[model samples]
Target: MYRSVGLMAWKAVRALAMSMTVVSGVSGCAAVQPASRTAGAALGLDAYYTQSVGWAPCEEGKTGEWFAETLAGVECGQVRAPLDYRNVQPDGSSGAQTVLLAVARRPAAEEKTGTLLAISGGPGQTGLDLIEAAYPPEVLAHFDIVAYDPRGVGRSTPLIQCAGGLDPDLDLNADDTEALEAAERTEVAACVTDTGLDVLRHTGSDEATNDVDLLRAVLGEERINLLAYSYGTQIAAMCALRFPANYRAAILDGVVDIAERPNDMRLGQERGYQATFTRVASFCVGEYRRDGAECPLGTDPAAAEEIFQQLLRDADARPVPVRGGSPVKATDVLDASYTGLLWPSAWKPYLAALQALRHGDGTAVRRLADFQDSEGTNALTAITCTDTAGPDHRSHSQTARRRS
Candidate 1:
């Protein structure tokens, strides 16, 4: 389960920090020249994308299907880059081919502050969508928002491939774990090694940081404002570290400390779960006491936890039918509970889920299961795994199963 690290405390600290900073980072603008197709050296553009993905223009009220679609009043374009950034013209035709997928939006009004580049997370998550959503009328009135998807990601060519099937809806029983693990192992081997070690090697915080500088130059911004989330924070931090001059300020949500990298994600998530369990249990206990009927739990919270454990074990053996679609399994239950950890808003749904599980009603439980499955995209996993230093071909299926 993913968890926020000290949400209450961090919110206070972040609020204070943000208050100390000025609201507007871009101001007092002089007339700027039009952007050039070629990113020149003067703007500190070291790399260029030679390929691009198309952005279907936004209609009156149409939403971009995926994250990278262009927003209203925004122009969408694609930039192509080399599969290998180091050697741009690998084929010797015209250096190597490189594409940078880009989405830029501005207010319908003429006058605007500047462009604020919005970056998304998952390393694989589409940053373009964030720009379109975050840059509503209020923000758009001030600045044009630009976002891009990195290589091997959304709309970016040569997508990373995981050998295993990512059918989130599939129920993974003990009988299925072995097959699932094997498939995952196969998929990982294929996707990670597809570009060989070079691209995979370069696909870290450092390279992404450098890429931002190139983007800044290509977009023709003297300095850019950045709003990033989750893994996007890592990319922004890298950009700041490498090209501190390129940024005015950055707003980071679900921020990740660069130094923490991969280790903190799992450990921090576990701590967050432990805390949520405490909060959720309190809610359950309070509700049980208020109802006073049979009490949700036979005895106290301790007994309730025991009952929950029993439910999980039972679910593992055989799925309890819910929603008329399929039965709810332990894995489904785990995923739903884990999804709740992503945000405080999910607490209510989680509460409902627990009640449903208690009564053997699988519909509510299935909803949670579906939410969990929704997130199990192949791209997210690839990006996460690639960010780490490990054997691209190695499979942890056996280990994962043993742990389970």
Candidate 2:
């Protein structure tokens, strides 16, 4: 996690600490509560709460080989979720459609305390595959570390893929904000309409929280301790709100209090980026940079942003050439730089990209910009669009893009 004067570094650090603390604590025993009595009772779920999970190796194609080698105990399973959580059968027998939620867990070495459910930041990102490597062995030693693919995410039943998987051609840097807004809205609307509104309509934070509760019942645990990052903090908070008794300790890092809308969160994200960009620019000209490398921006941190702004302007005119991919326009660069500043690990490379960008090669920046996207962008967009309630979030983009 990256931090600056205005941005909070503690959010990212706390998220990591949440992953680490399970081992240092005393072990907790499971109550083996019947699903019908706990999670099922709350949600009116039928057999879903009590369904025994048959833990298997990596769930065939769900996990990559790297995770299997890194975390030896990691196992994959699926929990069923209703398509429409709001409208369910009166008898709780069956009325709504169900989908499989890909789940991953690494059981504790000793007596397990309550399970630590790690919800990743992107609502669309897949945790079942990569979450095992994120924590240390000591962390893995204390409790069952669990992660899952929210409905419509990786390996989940009935994937919601756009016609070309988020349209790699959608550029963020169009001069006209209206054009960009229209393009974005049209693309997402097509995805929702094509994928069926019923499925897209159900991908809300409230519904996702129910899935979390269902997961608790599947594990037969009394309460689940939440460790969440980015947008996941919202989901964890929602769980805490809905099932207060079922939640143990919820650690929200990079906390997103976007109970209103993305714009509300976007305003704060802008502050975080401004602070991080200032820090990154200062570091670029500092002694820590690569040996024998000249500071590209002439050591004046104040003027550094002006230089970068010029780069965005220039790139917007003639989109920078990316290696073996679409040309990156100014909008792409903006999105990329914003994404890079979110994590500290990407800072060095981002700086390198900026340095190279000055010399006319944007491959590095373009690559970092591309890195902002994961396989789950469609899911992220869909869930984000449907989950939060407010005036359209994209209106703010017009204000951002209009700046000269």
* TM-score of every prediction relative to native: 0.67, 0.80
lDDT, candidates in the order shown: 0.55, 0.65
| Candidate 2, superposed: residue stretches over 4 Å from native | 1-40, 59-70, 164-178, 258-262, 290-298, 372-375, 389-404
How many angstroms is residue 103 displaced in model 2 relative to the true structure, after the best TM-score fit? 1.2
State the displacement of the C-alpha of residue 295, model 2, in Å, after optimal TM-score superposition: 4.7
Query: TM-score winner among the candidates?
Result: 2
- State candidate 1's TM-score: 0.67
Please state the error at residue 82 of candidate 2 in Å. 1.3
lDDT by residue (tens digit), candidate 1, 94-119: 54445455554554354565556766
lDDT of 2 by residue, 148-241 (tens): 7777877786676666434466655448788777777776777667677767767656677788888887888767777766677777766666
Clashes of 2: 3
